[model samples]
Target chain A: MPLLEIRNVTRRFGDFVAVDNISLSIESGEFFTLLGPSGCGKTTILRMIAGFDLPDAGQILLDGQDLAGTPPEKRPVRTVFQSYALFPHMTVAQNVAFPLKMARCSADETRQRLGEALEQVHLTDKAPAYPHELSGGQKQRVALARGLVNRPSILLLDEPLGALDAKLREEMQIELINLQRDVGVTFIFVTHAQVEALALSHRIAVMREGRVEQVDEPARLYAFPKSRFVADFIGHINLLDAQVLEATHGHLRLTIAGLGEMIAPPLAGAAPGGKGTFAIRPEQVRIGIHGEVTELKNHFPGEVTHFLYRGDVTVYKVRLANGMMIEALLPNSAPGGAELFKVGDPVRVGWRHDAGVFLHE
Target chain B: MSDEHANLSPAARLTKWLVSGPPFVFLLLFFVAPSIIMVVASFRYPGEFGGLAPVAAADPATLQGLTLETYRFFFSDFIYTEIFIKSFFVALATTVICLVMAYPLALLIARSPKKSRDLMVLLVILPFASNFLIRVYAWMILLGPQAALSQLVNGVLGAVGAGPVHLLFSPFAVLIAMVYVHLPFMVLPLYTNLEKHDPSLLDAAQDLGANAWRRFWHVTFPLSLPGIFSGSTLVFIPVLGMFAIPDILGGTGDMLIGNLIKEQFLGTRDWPFGSTLSIMLTLAVLLCVWLAARVGSTRGRYA
Candidate 1:
């Protein structure tokens, strides 16, 4: 059994549904992420799991026990807020020791736990300083230490690193993963940044419009999204509107408007002669000079409409004969590698079988 | 025109002063002139009949006529000292009571929805629409021995074999009127400060395992200290020098420093002694404000 199970929970505020019927199971010690844009109910779900909010319908179970009416303080879950919510009046040590103090732990035990928690976040030396004296990164670490000091069964983080700069955020992400691994506690994280979700989560549940669009491991979700919204949301993907020409046992042949016909791997629930969308990641497509793509399964002659040089990689927007625009990304292996393709240069773009996914939406 | 005023030349400075001259001259004429007169009068001897003796123009001996006798009389008299102490105690009591009553009401208004919060603040200020003296007199009727409130209390006491209690003409009546009159001063500052506080801080405290009481003790109360300090100072300073409340509600034996000053100035016609008392009251108020500011700063450093 999973460590936490949310069974068809729904929460409504007046006429608006903030969290629709959402069900999820989180395994022990798993790094789970709720990824969505703002107002997509990701934070609401995290709050509900932390017992700060109660669902209007259905139940939340922790260790097979129903948590229907447990208050946040009584629940065995701690949350790291987005603002880092350090008590401005308390010292770092005092903030971290708060939960233990509330539980009426022995003084020695509280001190020992606070020390260890601060050490885990590498902020032990700054224990006597107040929250106002710390930088944004240090404040975030203090908040993390405070949340972890309680040794809760599950930790809920609502965009805790959203306040940090890009470099500091990347550094903290690695530290967070290591800390979670050492503690071996289930972490339910929430974030709007897909890159952060992809880098840190063991499993991600992508949400939209008060509903979970898809839940899968990062790689599988990025490679084989089940819906057009999920495929577009997870990463950069070029979607082409197409019609299914043939659907036999485990294969599909699709004809995209202005682009040539292509065969897709088997996709469940797709009918013959039905409208669908063909999705492919930019990195999956290869760009070559004209007449140099013979080995690939699908090839099309195209002209480079625009190219962007992005230091480590370059992206090229290619237009085929039928006016369908496709994107291809190539690694900048050598200096000025993107100079190989100028605007209006004739090129052939190709992809192997299984590189693209077919979605009916 | 604004650009011209921003320059630091003498012409600009003169122009700036000229533009703002009326209010400054008015302050000097009304406030500074009277304070200077009071300071001069506090050092002079009282005339044989009343008030201060007029100093002769261009008479060098007039400077030597000033003496410290009024200040000496103020310190040497036990009645004056007792009145000062009693006034301080009454002001302190009024401040504490107002704080206790205003805090919860301010928190309620601060946490209320936007439209209701506006209405609550309006209600808090609505009592000021009436005259201050009239409001105190209204309390007089309510706390009188034959009033409904006093009769009800007397009924309760009579059930336990006690006689009718004297409710008015006592310190209790004075305290009730003082608290009622000064309560809005305490609540407004508190509400303003608490309204600006972030609600997420409470949620954060709760998320960290703090219950309602702990959340308030650990988060809300400490954060609202500025409000408390301001509210206390606002209530304490005005109530300290308030003469009307005690005069209307208090008995003959319950005279505060304000009434003593009034007696010296108007009843006894001792202008020098009255000026000395006024200066002492002003200094005391300044000292209290300074002390409150020092304490507020020390606590504010952490937040």
Candidate 2:
């Protein structure tokens, strides 16, 4: 049985539905993330799971026991809020020790666990410091320590790194991954940042408009998005409007207007002459000078209109002979590192037949 | 500091003084000078007619015609000291009652939706639109005999086999009026502080296994200490020296230090004794503030 199961939960505020009929099953000791934009019901689902809120219609079960009557204090779950939410008047030790204290743990046990939780977050030296005296990253560590001290079966984190700067966020992400690995706690993390969701979660549930769009492992979800929304939401992908020309056993031939026909990996139930989109990651396309032979059969001669230099890789926007724009990302790996293709340079772009996925509708 | 001031342009220097001059001069003239005069007046003897006697460098009244006679008389008797203790108790009771009544109201206003909070706060302050004395009079009427509230109370007492007792012109009436007049002071500061609190803290506490009452005791109440202190100070100080409420609604036994202080000057025409009492009240208020600060700091040190 799954460790936690949310069975068709719905939460509404007056006329507005904050979380509409969402169901999920979470395994033990897996980091799961509800990933979406703001107001997409991700945080609402997290709050319900933490028992701060009750679903209007659903049964949330933990260890196969229905959690309908359980209050937040009685539930064996904790949350690290986005704001850190450390009590301003409390020292770091007091903040971290709160959950243990609430559970009526023995004083000596609380002290032991408090020290262990602080050491886990690398915040041992900051035990005596008040929350206001700590930096943002320190405060975040304190919040994490507080959430972890009680050894809860599930820990909910609501965009805990969203307040951090980019560099600190990256550091925290690595720390969080290691922390989860060490503790082996079932972490139910909620975030709108796709990169963060990808880095920290074993499985990501993409949400849209109070519903789950897709739930899959990070790699699979990134490589094979099921809908236009998922393709646009997860990462940078060029969605070319096309129509299904013909469907073979393992491939579908698609036609882009003003461009030409192309082949994509097979899409189930892609009918002939049906409208769809060929979603391809920019890195999958190869951009090279014209007449430079490439392995890919699908080819287009174009001119580079613009390029964005992103340190590790440069993304070149190619204008095909038909005036259609397609993007190609090439690494800046050569010596004397700079963009190999400048703007207005003639180039050819191509991709393998199976490089992109064809999504109907 | 003088060097820093000297670096400023003439216009800047003049503008600096222009802003601070009025308040500085006002305090010097009205507050500081009157306090000094009162201290001096506390040492002088009362004239045969009224007010202080004429000052003389050497007179038979006592070396320099200014004696410590009023302060000596105050300490020689315990009746004046009893009024001080009674006034302290009344102020303390009023503060406790106001805090108990205002806390929930302030919390409700703070937790209410943003658009409605302004109207709730406005309602708190709306009572101040009427004259303070008129509002005290309104309480007197409510607690008066034959009034609906008094009749209902006495009716309950009658049913309980107890004799009907007076509600008006009693300590209860005076206390009710005091709480009524000063409730806004308690509510406003508390609301202001409670409103600024991040509600996410409570949510986090609840997630960490704190129940509703525990969340309040552990999070909300402690965070509002600044507002509580300020509100208590505002209510306690004004209620300590309040004379009109007791004069209008109080019985003979309901006398507070304020009534005694007033009688020294207005009834007995003893200016020196009045000054002496005012000085004592000032010292007592100072002591109360210091004691509150001490308690607050020590309590806050651990949490």
Candidate 3:
């Protein structure tokens, strides 16, 4: 059994349902992330788990015990808010010492725990400093220290790195991952940043419109998203409308309007001759001057309409004869590649058999 | 905006002053001048006929020969000193009571459900809309002997056969009146401060393992100190000089410094003593405000 189990939890604010009936289980010591856009109920779910919010319907179980009517203070779960809500009045030491003090720990124990907590965050030197004196990254570290000091069974983080700069956020993400490993505690993180979620989580639950669209390990979620929403949300995916022409022995033959017949790997539970959408990652499509199809299955003939010379790769907007536009990211290694993929240049776009996956439109 | 006024001259300054001079002069004449006159008169003795008679009519412009006799009189009398001490204590009590009551109410208002929060705030502020003197009078009716409250207590003390308990015309009445009158004054600032508090910070605290009480003591309370100071100062300063509520509910026997000042001025017909008492009251209020400001700054800075 998972350490924390949310069984059909539903939360509503008056007439508006913030979180629809949903359930998920978080395993022990796993860095689980709830990734979604704002108002997608990711934070609401985290709140429910932390006992800050009670579900209107269903139950939240911690360690196989029902957490019904348990106040946040009584719960074993702790949450780190987006703002890094450090006690502005208290010094870092006092702030870290608070939970232990609340738990009725002795003076020696409080001091020892506070020292360890501060040392974990590498903020022992600034223990006397107030929240205002600390930088954004430092404040977040302090918040981490305060949360971990209590040694809660599960630490809930609500966009812990959202307030940091890009560089700082990247740094903290690694630091947080390391911290989670060191503490060996179950961490349920909430964020709208897909990269952050994917990079940190042992498992990612991609949420949309008050429901969990897909929940899986980051690689699987990105590689084989079950829905168009999950696929589009995770990364940049070029969606193409297609009709499955044949289905035989775990292989699907789909005819796309702009790009003709592509024999792709079988999609689980999808019927042959059914209308579906296919998703291909931008980077997966190879753009070249040669129109001849290679060993790859899906090939499309198009004219490059616009070119974007990004530092790492040159992206081309290819316009097919059927008026459908497809994007391809090509490495900028060729000397004249910037000018080579000029406006109105005839180009061939091709991908492997497994590149395109059937998804709900 | 400054570029447009670059061509403006010193003459414009004079013109601006001239345009604003009437109200300034009018305020000086009515407000500032009388205050100075009161200070001057506080040093003078009562004349044979009554009212303020200049101690040194020969040098009408100055008060070089003024004595501390009025101040000495108030200090010498036990009644005046007792009343003065009682007023300070009561004001302090009122301030503490207000802080205790307002903090939770302010927090509730700040954190209440959005749909009902506004209406709840309006309800809290509704009592403030009522007439101040009328509310005190209403308290008098409720707390007076043979009043509803007195009868209720008497009913509770049935075994003793106490028909109607003596409830009003006491310090308790004075304290209740002061707290009731100034509770909103305390709550408004606290609410404003608490409302401005970014809630994400509280979540940050919880995530840190700080429990509910710890979060409040460390985070919430410290953040709201400025509001607490302002609210307490607002309540305490005025409460020291509050005469109307005490007069109506506290009865004539239990008088405060304000009542003492009023008695000196009108009843006893001693303008100098009244002026001295008023000056003392003003000094006390200024002292309270300064102390509050100093304490607030220290606490807020550390908090």
Candidate 4:
């Protein structure tokens, strides 16, 4: 059984529904992330699981027990706030020891666990320092130690690294993953940055407009998005309007507007003559000339309209013969990779038969 | 004009100093000159009739009058010492009462929605619109024996065979007036501090298994110490030397240090003794401020 289950939870603030009928089941020891833009209710759902917010319509079950009216202090879950809200008047040791003290642990055990928790975050030297005396990264580590001091069954992180610089944020992300693994606790991390969510989470739940758009592993959620929203939100994906012209046993033909007809692998629930969106990542589209190779099944002759050098990859904007513009990311591995594509150059962009997926509108 | 200030020549800096010279001269003329006169008068002898003795540096007999006799008189007198001690207790009581009443009120205003918080803060300051003496007179009427509040209290006490209560000419009346007049001083600082607090700290405390009471004790109260220090100092210093509240509501025996100073200055017409008492009171206020700063800094070192 899953350790935490949210069953159709809906929370509304007056007329605005923040979390609209959201349901999730997080297994034990899973690093699950709720990824969305601001005001998308991902934080609201996490608050409901933490018992800071009570769901208006549904039940939240922790360890198979209903947590409908349980207060946050009584619940077996803890949260590391985005602000890293360390008690400013308390030293780092006292801040980390607060939860254990609240739990009525013995003095010896409290001290021992506090020392261990600080050591886990590598903040033993900072135990004597106050929260104001520490840096942003050190404050976050202290918050993490405080959150984990009680050995909660689940730890909820609400954009805990949002306040740090890019380099420190990346370092803390890896440190958080390692800490989560060492503690062996279930983590429900929330973030709006898709890169951080994809890098840290075992499974990512893409949220949009107070609803879960998709929940899958990082690789699959990026490779095969089920909707245009998820495809556009998770990463850079070109969503082309297409209609299924023919569906056979193993191949499905699509007629993309402004682009020629193409045959690809069959998609479930896709019927002939039905309109949908064809989603393909920029890196998946291989750019070449027409005479270079002819074995590919889905190839389009286009003109390179623009090119951007991104250090590791050069992205080229290719406009097809039918006037459909698509982005193609070519790795700058070879010496001539970046120079190969220039503005107004004729280029042929092709992809494998199974590179793109059919997405519902 | 902008190009003129952009140059950093010595003449421009002199112009800047000339532009800012009037306020310093004004302070020296009005404030510093009077304080120097008061300090000099406190060391001189009282005149035959009243006021300070004339300065006489030529004759040794008249120069012998520049003595510490007024300070000696103050220390040797028991009545003045008792009044000083009594005034300290009254100020302490008033400060405690004001803080107890203001903290929850300030917290409520800080936690309220923005629109209602503005309304509440306006209500806190609205009492200042009226004349302070008139407000104290209003309290005097409410606490009088024949007033409705006292009559009601008497009615409750009369059931138990007790006589009608007298509240107007008592320390309780003075305390009530002091607290009512000074409550805003306590609330405004506390409200500023509490409103500026990051509310997520409470949520983080609650998330860390702290219940409501623990959250307040560990997170809310300690974070508000600066406001507490400021509010206490604001209430304590002024309340210590306040003369009007005691004069209006207090009985004949309830003279505070302000009343004593007033008696020395106006009643006896002894400006030097009055200046000495005023200097002592100023020193006491400065001592309170110094103690408060010491305590505040020590507490804030960890915070």
Candidate 5:
């Protein structure tokens, strides 16, 4: 059995359903993420698991025991809040030791566990300082220590790094991964940033409109998105409205509107007369001034409508002969840091036949 | 401060004075002058009939001495000292009772949804729109012998084998009136402070294994100490010098320092003795304020 199971949970506020009938089963020690935009019910699901909220319909089970009517205090789950809600009145050590004290642990045991918790977050030196005196990063560490002090089986992080600066967020992301590995606790992470979800989670559940669109490993979720929403939401991708001409032998021949025809990978549940979107990542297409090559099964002659120089790579938005715009990215790997292409330059963009995937909308 | 202001242009200085001068002159005239007169008057001897004697009387029979006679007279009697102690206890009791009654109400108003919190706060302040004395009078009718509350209370006492007791014109009535009159002073400050508290802190506490009561005791209460201190001071200071509540609702035995002070000024017309008593009350209030501030600061480090 899964360590935690949310069985057909539904939550409603007034007439609006914040979380529709959804269910998920998480295994022990897995770094699972619920990734979505705001109001996608990601936080609602997390709150339900932490026992801060209840599902109107369905059940939540922890270790195969139904957690109905259990208050947050009795649940073996802790949440690191978005604001890092450390007690302003307590010292770092006291904040970290509160759970142990609540459990009625002996003085020696609390002290030992408190010391270990603080040291785990590298906050041992800040034990005596009050929360207001600590920097934001230190306060976040104290919050983390306090949550982990009692050694809960599962930890829920509600956008814990959302408040940090970009550089510090990167550093803390690494620390969080290492800490999760060391503690071996099931981490249920929630984030709106796709990069954060991809970088941190062992498995990603891409959510949209109170529903999980896909749940898979990061590489698979990125390479083969199941729907246009998943492909558009996860990262930068160009989507084209296509007409499926034929389907046979695990290959679908689709004609993209104004970009000509190409053989796309098998589109599940697609008929020859059906309509769907052809999705390809920006990095998959090769952009240059060279004409069509035989190695490339799909090639288009286009003019560079615009170029975005993002230091390591430049994305060129090219308008094809039929006025369909396609985004292609090329790394700045050539010598001397000069931009190779500018607006109005004629460019040839091509990709292998298998590079693009067909989504059944 | 003068040196810093010297660098300003004439118009700047004029603007500065225009902003600060009114309150400065007002305090000087109304507060500083009266305090100086009272301090000087407290040292003078009383006239034979009532008012103070001449400042420099030549006749030996006339009372014109600048002496500590009132202070000496005050220390020479224990009754006056007893009134101060009784008044202190009443004020302390009122503060504790107000704190207890106001906390839950304040927390409720603070935790209420934002759209309705204004309506709730309006209800708390709505009672204050009426005359204060009229409110005290309203309490009188509620505690009157013929009132249902008194009858119910006396009935409960009678059933318990205790003799029926009067509710009005007693210390209990006086205390009840005092608390009712001063409750808004406690609730407003507490609500303001509690409203500023982040609701997430309580959730964090609960998530860390603290039950409802522990969350309140450990997180909510400690954070509200500032509100408690302000409310306590607001209720304690005014109740210390309050005369009308006791005079209206209390029995003759409920004479506090406020009654004693009032009697000196109005009944005996002993302005010098009244000044001395007023000075003593001032000193006592200052002491209490100093002690409260010290406690607030010492515990306010975390808050």
Candidate 6:
């Protein structure tokens, strides 16, 4: 049985529906993330799971028991807020020891657990300091310590690293994953950044407009998104409008508008003559000097419009004869990669048959 | 290269000094000088004809020289001592009451939608425009022996059957007048402090595992301490020196320190005694301010 189950939970505020009939089952010891833009209701769903809010419809089950009308204090869950809500007037030690104090635990045990929690976050040296005395990253670590000291069944994180700079954010991400592994508790984190979600989550739920767009592992969500929205939202994907020329025996040929015929693996359960969209990641499309000929499948001829020099990869924008533009990412290590692609140069862009996925419009 | 020198012209220097000097001079002449004269008056001898006399005049009727007799008389008299304590207790009560009532109101005003908050602020400030003496007189008719409020309170308490009830000329009436007269002072500072608070802090608290009461005790109450201190000081300091409400509503039933001081200065013609009492009251206000500053700094150190 799953440790936490949200069954068709919906939250509405007056005339606006913030969470629309979302159902999720989180297994024990999993790092789950709700990824979406602002106002997408991902935070609202997390609040419902934390018992800070009640669902307008449906049920929330924790440990196989229904949680209805339960206040946040009564729940066996905790949240590390985006602001790192450390009690401003309390020292770091007192803030970490709050949950235990509220639970009426023995003073010695509270002190011991507080010490362990602060040590886990490497903030024990500054335990007597106040929240305003700490840096942003340190405050977040203190918030993490306070949330985890309660030993809750699930730990909810609402954009925990949204306030940090880039270098600190990367460091904290590793710390968070390690902390989760050490504690071995289910975590439900919310964020709008795709890279952070992809880096941290065991399973991710992509949300848009108050609905779950897709839920899958990071690799699957990146490789084969089911919808145009998810494909466009996840990463840089070149979407081309195409017509299904033929479909047979798990192999399909698509005639993309403005670009010539490209044959690829057939989409599951899609019929011939049906219009669909083809999504291919920029890195999957290769730019070579002399590779693809007619017999080679899923190849196109184009001219490079511009090249962007990224640290690890060189990105080329290729324009076909029919005015369809495609982006191709070539690694910096490729032979002649740095000097080869420039403005107005004829380029051959090709990909494997399995690279591009046919997505429903 | 010489922008600083170019900016520091004579007219600019004169303008800056001109703008800042008037207020200091005004304070020196109007406020500091009078205070110094009053302190000096506390030591001088009172003449037989009631004007201040040089100590060498040697009036036989009044005290001859700079004596501690006036201060001694005030401290030794049982009635004046009781009245001073009575005034201190009343001011303390008013401060506590104002804090309790103003905190939630300030929070509400801080959080209310803009239109409603503006309307409410206007309502809070409207009472201050009217004359305080006129308001106290209005309360007289309402709190009279035969008034409906007195009769209703007495009826509920089972003290009076159904007829007229007398709550006038009592300490209760004095307290009621103090609260009514000084409510705006309490609300304004409390509202200002609460308004300056960043609401994201509260949302941050709720997103954490804190329940409502914990959220307020740990987050809201501590942040609102400045307002509490300011409001309490504003209400308490002024109420301690108030004589109008006590004299009008209390009559002879309850005489506070302000009334006693007024009697010494004007009624009993004792300027030295009144000046000494005024100095003590000033010291008391200073002590209250010191306590407030201490609490504010302690909260700031933690927060």
Task: Please give, as one word, the docking class of candidate 4.
Answer: medium
What are the candidates' interface root-mean-square deviations? 1.2, 2.6, 2.9, 1.2, 0.9, 2.7
lDDT of 6 by residue, A1-361 (tens): 9999989988999999999999999999999999999999999998888776899998999988999977777788888888876777789998888888777789889989998999999998999998889999999999899889989999999999999999999999999999999999899999999999999999999999899999999999999899998899898999999888888886778888777788777787777778889899998887765744333576778899988999788889998778888998888887776787679888778888877789865
> Second chain only: TM-score per model?
0.90, 0.93, 0.85, 0.90, 0.94, 0.89
Supply candidate 6's per-residue lDDT for A72: 73
lDDT of 2 by residue, B1-303 (tens): 999988999999899999999999999999999999999999998876778887873656553577999999999999989999999999999999999999999999999999999999999999999998899888888888989998998899999999999999999999989999999999999999999999999988988989888899989988889889999999999999999999999999989989988998889999999999999999999999999988788657643
Among residues 3 or more apart in sequence or in different chains, the pairs in candidate 2 whose N, CA or C atoms overlap within 3 Å are none
Of the candidates numbered 1 and 2, which has the greater DockQ value?
1
Q: lDDT, candidate 1, residue B3?
A: 82
Q: Residue-wise lDDT of candidate 1 within B85-193, one digit each (tens)?
A: 8999999999999999999999999999998998899999999999999999998899988799998999999999999878888899999999999999999999999
Candidate 6 colliding pairs, count: 0
Candidate 1, A20-68: lDDT as tens digits: 9999999999999999999999998988988878899989999999998
Please, what are the lDDT tens digits per residue for candidate 4 over residues A83-153?
99888888999999999888999999998999899999999999989998999999999999999999999
Docking class of 2: medium
Clashing pairs in 5: none
- Point out where model 6 deviates above 4 Å: A291-296, B1-19, B55-80, B153-166, B195-211
Give the interface RMSD of candidate 6: 2.7
TM-score of each: 0.93, 0.93, 0.85, 0.94, 0.94, 0.92
Off by over 4 Å in 3: A8-21, A56-58, A248-251, A266-272, A291-297, A334-337, B1-32, B55-64, B74-79, B96-176, B194-223, B245-252
Q: How do the residues B1-303 of candidate 5 rate in per-residue lDDT, one tens digit apiece?
A: 888888899999899999999999999999999999999999997777887888876786764679899999989998888899999999999999999999999999999999999999999999989999999999889999999998999899999999989899999999998899899999999999999999999999999999999999999999999999999999999999999999999998999889888998889889888899889999999999999899888878886
Tell me the lDDT of candidate 1.
0.90
Q: Which window of 10 residues has the lowest lDDT sum in candidate 5 chain A? A: A286-295
Once fitted onto the true fold, the runs of candidate 5 whose alpha carbons sit more than 4 angstroms away are A248-250, A267-271, A291-294, A335-338, B1-16, B58-63, B146-164
TM-score, candidate 1, is 0.93
Q: Rate the local accuracy (lDDT) of all candidates.
A: 0.90, 0.91, 0.84, 0.90, 0.90, 0.85
TM-score for candidate 3:
0.85
- Tell me the lDDT of model 6 at B114: 74
